[model samples]
Target: MDRKQHIAIFTTASLPWMTGTAVNPLFRAAYLAKNGERKITLVIPWLSLKDQKLVYPNNTTFGSPSEQESYIRQWLDQRIAFISGFTIRFYPGKFAVDKRSILPVGDISEIILDEEADIAVLEEPEHLTWFHHGKRWKTKFRLVIGIIHTNYLEYDYPRSIVCNVHGVNTKFLEIGKKRFEQQHGSNQAFTKGDYYIGKMIWSKGYGELLKLLHDHQKELVGLEVDLYGNGEDSDQVKEAASKLKLTVRVHPGRDHADPLFHDYKVFLNPSTTDVVCTTTAEALAMGKIVVCANHPSKRLLQAVPTTGTEKLSSKKFASVSLNLWKTIEDTSAYVHHLALGFEATRRVFGAIPGSLQPDEEQRKELGLTS
Candidate 1:
């Protein structure tokens, strides 16, 4: 029998971080490992928040690195206990406050070599200085795939793939829906209001959202906005929202699969920096109309019928948001289709191609030949 192909995924962060880079790759790893066709090693940078004395936005507290690793292992084992070929490996690293990331230190190339990975997937390769320097890991793996998760422009690698949005785990969405229905009844209705769930940072367009509310106070007289997230700028966001005439409330972040997420009629996101805004996809999958800023990275979202993209300005943002709210129709019918849209876009991860042999065009793309 052919041996299982060993695939090592090097990611910037893991469970305790609660960011897209951490969560997305994790789900991909779990889903890919479920079938047990290949051996998967999810490599994450490790550092204790207590040791670093750093305040993480998600408000999760870990006593030590071992505790964090144990928690993650337990979580994964509980969910994927049947999968024997899966593993999670932690490497020593430090958190970068400015970047809000745990960058892997030491020799990562040697680490990947030690794993004997037939394929190495670098999630957000640009964030890893050691991997994106070119040609270093090129000859080592049968194929090196760089999955760009950010908007960084300078970093590019052989066999690079740009996935505008990653796939959502339909199982979680189904569970949330079922729980909601069980508690509220099948005909339960959503509250009439706007909602936003993501990092509470300023770059998420909190300034734009507040300005839109302030400038259009008269037109949006009865509009209510509920924002849920945790970030270093949480207090600042709350202070800004307090001055607005509209009813805006800031709350701590919740799990992406929380049923509360489905209790809103509209979802608003004005951030353009996200290369793959996972929450936006989740909102749409839950049948909520999403109003976000127009950007090249949001191309996939723009294609969804329930999503609207507008220029990043208070005026246009308010106009599109109110227009979508006013013209809103029943969205329940679009859930399945929207989920399929995201799943189809991210099918590459569902069943990764086994063959490492690249065709002439792919060979050129991988720089295998002149």
Candidate 2:
């Protein structure tokens, strides 16, 4: 919407860092590049080392502190610029996603101002607590709109911040009101994939989801839940699966897309932190039913309100309910919102916002009919 603004995406980690959170943004930038309008730049601490080179743009590079500020120095000491208006140097990594820590809010804010960003797509506010509350930043451009890919709200509810959802909760998948609009026209189920790929993390409800599969082993006759992605809890996940006696096949990697194509039935979204899962959207686009842990992030409460529970709430906006379709629509809106920004510059936006041909192509390559 603003004059073809320069966009810079800075990530604490690289693509597939942990399922949807890191992967989607890089894909979004790659998609924008197709339109050949707005300049897109990605500054991540580390770029994932996966086999598939075609899925993500070749342009993206990495410079971040991995072994404690070593990479951070590299990013800062060297001026990194990839695309026009899109630039990323380095920011101190002092906080986890939900954990509160203000490391380089001032420095990042300076970069946002220097670039004259129309919008700052912040990952986790705990990383930039200062800029999250800065009202004066609006004088520059749209403020930090946090991308809640986890489906569960992780923050203490920072004020004046809006978020985007990726998919339903961790256990169930339903069509969102907005997401179902196109599907209702056909009344057809979203395309089902044979296998799914994602990080096997705790909040993902992998244990319960495996129990459901193990209990419903008969129902899961032809289906196999495949998992890929790295985290600290991989062994625990394997242990749970073994305990549950799930017949899931797992191929683990950091940034690798499996060579085998799967007709995935359920895209496992286990994140309880944010609202949407990028891989969930990737799965949906691939035509799979996403079984997400709705409100996995919040503490269990007796009363289950819409988004997940009544306990969690954002600062200004009331936390919405987490359901199957709700997640899809929220994520779709975020993508579409980004698309509006990307398209405003001249690139042909995809049906899904902040996405491009690779989405369709990637899925098709995976043998997805949709």
Candidate 3:
């Protein structure tokens, strides 16, 4: 019989606070575990001042701080390291260290010492400080994987296992390619895009969008920029719009707000730090043109309106000329332009098996990450 390959998924977060890096690794690990191809263990820490479930796989109560220690203790007691949070099937795996005093390196190293894993993958290698301890873990895991999702990593990472691009936008890829070329020339690199775009955040920067609309309305009269989202940012958005003397409307959120683009000619993405920039995809998904800045995904759309040459460069702003062009120009043709791109990309990556909580669909429909 083939031995169950031991694998450790190291995360730098508590379950509840787990980000995409933390979540995606588990998804990949779960798929491998379900196939009986490997024994997968997820290591997370307790970061909450008050204990809570960091992330109980598949919505099962397994890894919350409240349930974590007891659950892990029980798993160790049973000599079981990995279990399918989706299928609840018992599989052999290990978990011991996390984001506490033990850095990502310490936690991963400790687990290797204890269980002597066969493979190791890290969510954020920036959190790992194991260069000196390389020999200690050299023969422990056959494969050591790392995820790099930011352009900054182009400078920080000595080498990358895989580049998980957040969205499949041509513009995003163009900038990434430029950044990569700047670093190592246009060489073949292992990279994938995570298309989780157009999320309706609670703080939908209506204020910023409103400010744009408000300031430009005189030159671009009666042009409505459809703002889609929910959250604390609602009032600020509305107030910003009010100050700009532009009309503001908030609609109910959707799992895939494709229908929202029907009447809207322009899409506005006013995010300051979210790298994925879902609206850039939503706009492309609907072929509704988007006004995004330095966003890698913006290139996939019809036009970028502006481009940035330097990091955080404000390459272009809403100029009187651009606003006039957008307000009167025919925008009806751009709405479905990005459709073909979205579908092709989805098919290739969707086959990568990953488990979502039983409640995930409902939560998505309800527009709550809770």
Candidate 4:
């Protein structure tokens, strides 16, 4: 009989955050754990004070300072108290240690030492420090896998382990790609002209879309930009659009498959720091032209190839629609290629070897004495 493989996945972000970098890998990890017969543990950080305040404010029983600790402990305990059949256990940690700074009360190193996992996967850059500097778990875990969701990890990483990255979903990016394709039809047609869907944050680049509209005001006569979704920056977004003298409408939050996709002609993604946004892929899957204001990092440029996607331009904002059939053809190919890339990465983790080493150059660059 074969011994079950013990794997531990670490992330500084947890559910309800809505940030793709933290959420995507967790989703992928859950999918892998459920499908495999291995024992998996997910070590995640506690919600930050800011997020906690935003989520449970003055109106609730968690308002008082003295009661905050109890409430937090209660929340963490409840999160782990539930049992599931997937063979994956969630271990919430106190504070997270990153490269540049330490997250207050978010440490998970003790949990890592306790697990004695055969395989360890690090999702955040700071996780590498635990293995590299802590030394205890370096030899314990046979393989230490790393995942780089964006350019953040491209600059510096531990000399040890391979960090896979540079990768999307289609109509609604919030949901899984397979589910979206299964329910909405992968080759569905889109008739709507121009719209933006996602969080109203500065990083997502909603303001850039407004600028495009404001710049092309004369050409896009009678056309109004529709904004959907809510975030901490919602008021700022409204204020920016008002200053631009752009007509923008706010819609309540809804699922990705809401009829909105069919109501717009083109989809715009102006995100400044996205690795590869799900909304862009969804628009591609629906055969809609996606107008991107800024380019993604070089490592992730393949995921947002120029073939099916358009670079935002000052000249042709209003006259950039392509033929429906051609647009669909380009997007369909891109979607298929993206799906294959994701599956390949999943297989890499599922079949990792017992022991691994850092390349010679990597070690030399880091000047590791050990």
Best by TM-score: 1
Highest lDDT scorer: 1
User: Listing every candidate in turn, what is its Cα RMSD in Å to the true structure after a full C-alpha superposition?
Assistant: 16.7, 16.8, 21.3, 17.2
lDDT of 1 at 220: 94
lDDT of 3 at 12: 54
User: What are the per-residue Cα lDDT tens digits for candidate 1 across 58-166?
Assistant: 4566655557667776755654435555677765555656566565444455556543758988887766642121224545677777777765543244324454547
Q: What Cα-based lDDT does every candidate model obtain?
A: 0.66, 0.44, 0.41, 0.50
Where does model 3 exceed 4 Å of error? 13-19, 49-116, 128-140, 153-156, 161-211, 223-242, 248-291, 294-370
lDDT of 2 at 225: 63
What TM-score would candidate 3 get against the native?
A: 0.44
lDDT of 4: 0.50
Q: What is the TM-score of candidate 2?
A: 0.49
User: What digit string (tens of lDDT, one per residue) describes model 2 on residues 1-370?
Assistant: 5556556665544432344434455555554554567766654432222311212233333322243234333432332233323333443232222322112322334445555566666655434332222233334456545554333343445233233433332212222433355456865443544444555566556656666777887766766566664545677777766654446765665332222333334556555554444555545554456566646343222323344335545633444434645677657545644534442331342122222212343333323234
lDDT of 3 by residue, 225-264 (tens): 4444433244554455455444555553332333333334
lDDT of 3 at 36: 71
Q: What's the lDDT for residue 52 in model 1?
A: 40
Segments of candidate 1 deviating more than 4 angstroms: 49-59, 63-66, 73-85, 113-115, 130-135, 153-161, 172-188, 299-370
